[model samples]
Target: MGNNNGRKGPGRREILKSAGAVTATAALMSAVRASFPGGAFAQAAGPETDKVTLGFIALTDAAPLIIAKEKKIFDKYGITGANVAKQASWGTTRDNIVLGSASGGIDGAHILTPLPYLMSLGTVTAENKPTPMYILARLNYQCQGISVSNEFKGLDAKADASPLKEAFAKKKAAGKEVKCAMTFPGGTHDVWIRYWLAAAGIDPDKDVSTIVVPPAQMVANMKVGNMDAFCVGEPWNDQLVHQNIGYTACTTGEVWKDHPEKTLGMRADWVDKNPKAAMAVLMAVMEAQQWCEKMENKAEMANIIGKRQWFNVPPADIIDRIKGDIDYGDGRTVKGSDLLMKFWNGGVSYPYQSHELWFLTENQRWGKLPMDLDTKAIIGKVNREDLWRSAAKNIGAAEADVPKTTSRGKETFFDGKVFDPADPKAYLASLQIKKVA
Candidate 1:
């Protein structure tokens, strides 16, 4: 990881500047201590490791981490210095989390929701060393999309794949295969695309090919005729539409409203060793998330993240989607939608156990995890809701903001499929397209 300026290392001046900043932050925290009651201020402590590095990909949802670093929110929370490093891909993010700080990689990252579980289970690890990871918080929700190339321009396939099945068949018969791409196998994007295809009786595995492509490269791959369609997070999806390479089939929110997407993932060892530091990071990011979810702050957020050091795309490409101004690039436009990326509001930041259960169940459905695995036990071990609650309490979060229970009950998908966390096995059996065995 590089310095905050994206340079190889910090200079002596940078170190001195960081120390002065921390001294100023301490003064500010002291001044605000008299406001909160019940010694809430006593519980908040400086991070064990004030200087730390975090990883992020080139996606809009990575805003909270970037904002926390850019706006000095981390410094205010006793994280004297923080570096937000750019990861090449989600796989690299996973690998870096596994390697951890000891190997000069990341301590944590903005990662896919299911990745922590998979990493904990050693399903997609480098050396099968099942790294114990914890979900600090969910970063954002419902800003991903499934996109198809211009070849499917005239297809009447909005939320239904029946019309596109024939094209896939024809292409196959003609000795050319239709392919779909997702950021990672068994990730949120893959699951969404799989669910969409399966809902219309088209098998993702049998009907067409599914391949892995990094989010940033998705539009380029589609442009070069490498894939027929792709499911990815913005601004790539929006970038594709802008570049006339592809059109939106449907937003992931249309598939599953307010779907959990990226998460703040950290190694369990790091959390245990630096419990106060972990809370500091969480508190700063929580504040940053609230700032990001505000409508007034979105444009500035877009400009900050769209810089060459961050997402490296035009601000306009990133701004429209954050404001819920959507263009499907096929003559369809949505003026505004409540289904845009939500960073803080609507309990979007809560690490719901039910959500993780759904992810585990999907992993099982796709043969990524065994169906007989103890989901409740695994979830309890992986999801640190206790830590989240503690952070919330220390930060003086609103009473309603803290959930009464970890379970969000049940969720209903766009295809009318219901997932009851209590009866995950039954839900698995009911799924028409799955490989539970």
Candidate 2:
């Protein structure tokens, strides 16, 4: 009885409606919420279930989920023994989340922030039937890189990618296709590289081929001269520079300062089925984000995630840029830069509805989504900021520390483009290099 997508269809409600099991389930969740008013479910009050399988790619931003499991914070919050499985790629992660753990896949994941929305709308799924996903928290801000091959080393594109337009033009005129790789279609990396190229007057869709490459494969693909430029999360980008294969043009944060990246996303049905357990898992991951954001934790964090069982990367590849030290690999170096990744810098991990709007708008500009799509209604269905708020208070976050508003006000990008969440259509109309006319 599987659906056209990875998940099974005609759920428990359909099969058990006459048995009253669904009613009992709802009653249990209501009772649990009443007992734990702050949303902090611990061992004493207990959870409906003690385990769920979560997935993550080998990116540094997946640290919160791994740290929670490694440090037994999940155990502390009554989500004891939750599995943090490693995903081979973003596409696999999507399929698995749809499949759910009971069906031999995953329950949730450290996913691209835009992906949950796309999946929820069924835009990227096989039959275009919504998966009903939920974005619980933004995992990190910044630290993704747009890197160029050493062939363009002299160009040194820097923050403005205009320098590479001529080189790309020459490549195209030579009767060869120019390729730019990103981790997933309509995901953060795709949007970033597209924005970078379009800002320089290069058409990402028409001027160059946008290919899908997993984050882990980006370095090897570049080493073999498979792509001219790529956008991805660390520690792969740092590894590229270490191998002398490429130099980073700019960290994504430079393009749009404090930009949202990965997210802790899960199937909405899972949250509904296990409300208390979901809150417990959210609280544990939030606590881990706080620990991961500390300056002193950088070395240890790098060492832990670098182990073969995890990212299998070298700590040296991860530690440098993680602590704000950068070696651009083209004779430019920065010490203690502000462009380092932020795990829980104040409300950095809060899932702002405003940030999600920009992602949808960017996807619209590129034709991945319909221009007339109901962005606000979709955001309302997919973003569970209310759940995030509950977890924050229960996790002992000071009231002052919690964000009062869902919007981060207006966001401005490097090329002087501004995205006011209040006027996404205006932002879309202002873009010169877009698929939308």
Candidate 3:
């Protein structure tokens, strides 16, 4: 619905992404100037496109959508009629996609990773049946982090023990629940926080209580002590550091470097019905991703995305992180700006079946789903790789641009085990934490 950064949120990296979008657009404009020689700019020839609508939840990683719209990437791809609507929450975003509320009238949405999974495996509790959504492309990765309150700074557990041990000890010593929060259960943030905590020998179920709070409300809840710590996407984590209320204990990327963050999700039915429109949308977003990766465009990206109409936060706050600058506070900051976040760099944008399998395995491990479901079958039904491949090809994405043939990629879980997707059963069985199921 909204974002967590208190003062109009979009922190540093978002601003930089916005600037990059503009610079890319300017470069394209310059090409026109040289060729036209003071003549009128030629309108790109394509199908009549306008009034295309999309949805977002106001996170920093949503920058590419804003940048694309601002730079007319949609128009460039003949996708006019563009309107971006900020949904109330991830649930609402999910509901719209499932019920055909968003796609029935317009296009699709910038959705969370759990969406497709939930769609394939209905929310039995909610009695919601599978809606079968598909992702057009990936938006960004390695952008979320876990934040801890500054009040717990001096606790010896904070430094000497794992986060799980530290949180539990602090809570018991204070005679209060060491409450930790994440945006959603069965979502990437929750999975990372729980997996990370469990890796350090902390029982997420008993040692600490995990709660779900909306991203925009995380900082407020932490400020009022409604929660002790939270794992969320930028710029909320960055905002906490700046306010000195909290600090980044670990990045999701640290949990699994280059982990999936956000994606452009559409219903499978919608893709089947409007393949051309879907491909066009993918092309526009992919171009937007390329624009975001240009380092020189960082400043201009900040200016555009930091504006009142977009993320609407101070350009400085969003700039540092978007540019890959890290400020862990307590006198710690790093300038690995390239690590900030990325949108596109070829095959990195597709939704891999292996990625889905890892999430499914984690869900099963955490007791969110019953242990007997067929992981491969569910993944095949949910991933929609055929559609993604078509979109990628239409956009000129090469075969090598996609991820490895299998899910196996490089990962170093802080707990010390290296996960190889090729041997997932072994990876799941090797865990030392409680297996609720």
Candidate 4:
């Protein structure tokens, strides 16, 4: 979606330029590695498999995977043939992971945080065959947004959708629909939009039609009037504003600050067969996340991921949000904010079970999971925090970097509602709008 109409592949001239850049980056990383005690590139017991393919969708949050490949971090960790292939949509990502690498699919992916759980529960699988999966680390937090078309211009709406509900009702009476789009049905984007809509007394299930659109295709779809509003990760939301097609109503962080977004997910079978390799991949991504979190590296990161092969968006569009320079596209701007997308800072890389539990509860709220389901058992099997701890130790991460507790305790949302991990059911009951059947 970043204007790749004429490009087939990088021309010879472009290839040479990329090669030179890689060479310079390699030299820089080599010096940094040498300075660290025992060297960051020092290999432990070699990985079980030397090659592994991973899938990613075209979103800014997929930077960790791209950075790992570009900076040779995967190779340093002995994952020699690590491939970060781009995926068309979240549904395709699920199918490919279900197929597995032996069947010519990816062994892992930079995936929506809840997708691996859905896959493991046979919720999204075509054949209803559960594909066991594990979340190695959380890739990012925040930086997703809900954008509304020009039709809602000058509307006094922030976190509340009350202003839009009457408009939607009038449209419905006229046999027209007010639709909202998200990347996946039960994903973070969907949940965010749903929460925002419900907070304003608009029932997401009954008041509006919800649809799925891939991240890269969001702007194009919106431009052609496929949907009235959409919630997705950047830079599609930012692009909509740049093109004057829509304006960001509010960011997900504004809805709930520092909320978990994406994850580095892999098949549980693959991890079982290749424990050391899984740890190696985790270490590589962890280092890449740390590198991406640095203030100085953001511009370079935006440039690298904005290339045609990755996100395919312009660097200018991606750089602002990464640096916390947010333009809400409705005559509002924030020079910088701590609520920007986080890769490693604020214990973001650590996969908190409490967050996963919240996601699970939301899925249940939306009728994606049964209310009576044993959530703790499902979380135990899917969340491999033990592997994360082991990987952190092997990588010589500081003790403070690793959390002493698995849970981040009770989390409070922008709506003044609290989600206590210890009492998930009560939290669910307190929500006025839910479809927990």
Candidate 5:
């Protein structure tokens, strides 16, 4: 995230809300229609609730939610009272998600893909009390970056993380703590960095102390030498490279291409109580996703989300990376790489149950979840792909937009390890590094 150029303090945070759709005009509606010819959903029964409060972090993937609110897509879908608020950190997001809007928090949020499952099972919640949540949609995939301090710029780690193993070992040998940072403990950033380190034979759990830093604070903290390396979504990594504090070693997409990242998550009670309203939210976000996928809209999207009330960032830090232009900052720059973040990609938005299984398996591998846990049962309850399809149908989504099956098939990693969702045990057994058997 970009530095808050005079946009600091709590007052600006209070203004980080969606402009109500009440002021939407015919011109904007016509523009929205031009963006997606097939995206307009037929008028039906109005949403039960006109308003729904949601939360988002200062990350690029949160654009769908922001765009939905900013472009008045929520209003078009009959949710006139939609608001997307900025959250301080993933911890704050978790706390607010646990404390529903009725309790002065939020009803739903742009969350880490594994968070819904983690929150649902009480593993990541306080007092071990379950806060059931549903994964409504996969927000976006790939383009998140693993950035390293400029101290290792000469090493030119890039996609192969082997050089860092020796550097971290030497740092530890000097009796210094080798800290590797991520935004949240079982979130997408955590998984990406862990997988990258482990592929190079570095044990993320023992080789280095993994620390938690908020996405927005990554650049600031790194500038002060708070951490050696960090894994986070866009703008922060881009800012780090531009600030000369670090260079991006590689994007997480290099570890696993088109890998699932964040999700559109909501409280189960809220969805159950207001199913139609939830559908309205889904349709609006889905349409925004379509708007985000186009190449022409990227610049405008970056400018919109970079406003003071949203990410408080410059459009320069976001536009290039979002468009697949990566300046590694270590003398390597790739333009038009296939690793750009995908929003409404073909068959990409589906909330695949198999994707949830991979995260659950990884958490178990790292001892975050127990081996005996019934992950299948949890997935069945948390993954709402059925609702995704229903909303897609209601929105008149194209045939290419929806997947026939929930599984995206076997996924292969950079280490040549394959995770077959059908047989998670086989995949787990193949892993040489883990805290669990």
Candidate 6:
């Protein structure tokens, strides 16, 4: 997942039928007035922009883009002509936007968290100049899952749920260390999985080797024993379960409920130049976000995303967790958390400064960014809260939903003690096992 273009085998109609129920529910809810508070869409700002081009990477989290188009949210907001192209990968998504900024083709992108940070700091290609990009709003959260190959049955019975804990025990029994896979280095998937491992007393960098595989390649790598486990977004996790090659180890929701997973990214220059259009796009997507959060729309969204041209899997494969159902395939099946794809729950979707800083701190922890960089200045410049506020306001989002100020909440990862974002020095000092350069 995390915006992959891979496909697995087909699924059963019974699964599809359940999927249909989700679809029907979404369709019904789409027709209902948004029950949430204000009319974010009513008396919308007059037509300021007529055309737009958007990009996505073909994952379930791309639902906001798809639903907005399917439901004509863009048209509703006065943008008549829009292009939503599916990029090959997250890297490509960032590249396209960067190139578009230079060539005047791409406007904004559905991008990963590390993108703006890396780009702002000139960590990527040199040809691409600094394209100002900021967080519009969080698209969705807490849907990524860690899956273990079926061959690793011992993982299911490990004393701790953390894969790193199991990896340590398995290594003690054998001479070899376990292999864990993540999509990218200095990325959210890598950080979340690594934090989970370290919390269980396993050193991610020392106890096991972390490999970089495209989200699409995770299953194949696992099947070939190149990796013992992977943490990725869906429908890849669902694809693994459907293929009978792996079992769900733990969902990201278990680690941090409603954790920020994806966001709507725009070139900072684009936002500054086209503030009205930017706010309109956010409103349209927010409308879709509300639609997807409903129990009913899950199936239709799955069906659409499951097409070969998009996510390219069977609807059944993608429907379970989309509708809040979890299947570990270890004889464990549970309802998916409501926090599964929270578009706007408890100010969850709003980009918090502390949250952005968390990613920055993690980047430094892993040496993606220099250990001595001025992370606070970089984070403050890159995470554009002012832009997010305009878009949320345009959508009539409640003021209460927007936190007046960021909270450096005490956050404990899979590691034993909680972290104080305010005192990152202590937090970094507390780590016994770390990435040594």
Using lDDT as the measure, the top candidate is 2
Candidate 4 residue-wise lDDT, 65-88, digit = tens: 999999988877667799899999
Backbone collision tally, model 1: 0
Model 3 misplaced stretches (Cα beyond 4 Å): 1-51, 102-107, 155-167, 398-400, 404-406
Rank the models by lDDT, top first: 2, 5, 4, 1, 6, 3
TM-score of 3: 0.82
lDDT tens string, model 6, 1-437? 02223546434755675575475434323322232136433343343456778888666788888788877777666556767777776677777877774485577766667777787777764674666677777788778887877876655622245544654567747987578888776777898778777767677787778877777777778877788778888878878887788888777877775667777887777766655566667777777887787777778888877877767778887888887787776777788556365666567667777777777777877777788889778777777676666556656677767778766477765435556878887887887656634
As a whole number from 0 to 100, the lDDT of residue 417 in candidate 5 is: 96
lDDT of each model, Cα atoms only? Answer: 0.86, 0.89, 0.70, 0.87, 0.87, 0.71
- Candidate 6 lands at a TM-score of 0.82
Q: Give the count of colliding residue pairs in each prediction.
A: 0, 0, 25, 0, 1, 12
10 residues in a row with least lDDT, candidate 3 = 155-164
Question: What are the runs in model 2 whose C-alpha is more than 4 Å off?
Answer: 1-44
Give the clashing residue pairs of candidate 4, or none: none
Q: lDDT tens digits, residues 142-168, model 3?
A: 768788888766542321137448556
- Compared with the true structure, model 2 gives a TM-score of 0.91
lDDT of 5 by residue, 234-278 (tens): 989999999999999999999999998889999999999877678
Best of the two (2, 5) by lDDT: 2
lDDT of 1 at 85: 94
